[model samples]
Target: MKFLFDIFPVILFFLTFKLYDIFIATAVAIVAAIAQIGWLWLRKQQIEKMMWINLAIIVVLGGATLLAQDETFIKWKPTVLYWLIASVLLVSSLVFRKNLIKLMLEKQIVLPVAVWDKLNLSWTVFFLLMGAVNLYVAFSFSVDIWVTFKLFGATGMMLVFIILQVMVLGKHLKPMPERIQTVNEQDNLIEKIDNKAGKK
Candidate 1:
């Protein structure tokens, strides 16, 4: 559900492009992004920083597409956004010695420090490659094909990457301390009960 929500604008853009044209699609995408932020604001939800960044990028690039009557601006939007994310991930890890991925997921899953670094670096590289791939598709193909790739190809790649990451993480995740403590408590209680029953 959250994934669908996150990609709502892209889905709308693809459908609009099929029904209309690139210009109309770009407009719809811009409106959809604004509507997302508006809806969240109305609901008093804490809009994430990424959401705001996405909204800003769409408004600027999509607006340029509309104002200048050129689809190039909109086509570049994905690459720009992807590269920005990759830069953030790389800079945070290398310069500041902070692993943003670990900061986000450490509370939920525990892993060795080396694993955290590797995970962060992996995501950074993935986003960088994805940005380059978007550029390759956007310029190498027709607008229709680019739109299709934006909706399906890009999304499919991201899903596949996440599945691969999950497979890797599965091997390294450790049992939470709380879970271990609960299991130990249960075992001790069962052992005491068994000893009392044996004496009786």
Candidate 2:
């Protein structure tokens, strides 16, 4: 499934880091990311812009870490990606008058514009906070601990955030009488979330 495909790299990186060193884990992650994209391309699917950005971070930051024989660059990777996404979401919402969360979920779950704005702002704030947390853990903890934070802590928080989002959205779900949309739209939302997961 798309979810599995999206998480394959992070899982691989975690396992690789456990069995080997950070450099080895970085190499494995980069290869896994590339393979994921290639597999999607072979299916004639369009890769999300964010997936390419993730790959870039892995290769560039991971490459720097490997080249300098230092883990600092790699440690900053998640924070960099997180802040970048948060910035984009905030800018798009405020400057361009675009609510990305609503853009992604509008067809699947109808809600008032004000509610969508709140959801978008919520995600923007979440990403900003997540970025700060990544940096705090990276600098305040050991390499091993940071790796665990990257894989488990970040993922756990994300899952919790998603659950809360669902709970909030429950009250805003459109009435059943308006369920004229196809299942494909719902599936697309899943795909969107899966692609978003590529940030890790």
Task: Please list the residue runs of candidate 1 whose C-alpha ends up more than 4 Å from where it truly belongs after superposition.
Answer: 186-200
Q: What's the lDDT for candidate 1? A: 0.95
Judged by whole-model lDDT over C-alpha atoms, candidate 2 comes out at 0.90
Provide the lowest-lDDT 10-residue window in model 2.
175-184
- Residue by residue across 64-125, what tens digits does model 1's lDDT show? 99999999999999999999999999999989999999999988999999999999999999
- For each candidate, what is the lDDT? 0.95, 0.90
Collision count of model 1: 0
Quickly count the clashes in candidate 2: 0
lDDT for 138 (candidate 2): 94
Q: Which ranges of candidate 2 are over 4 A from the true structure?
A: 176-200
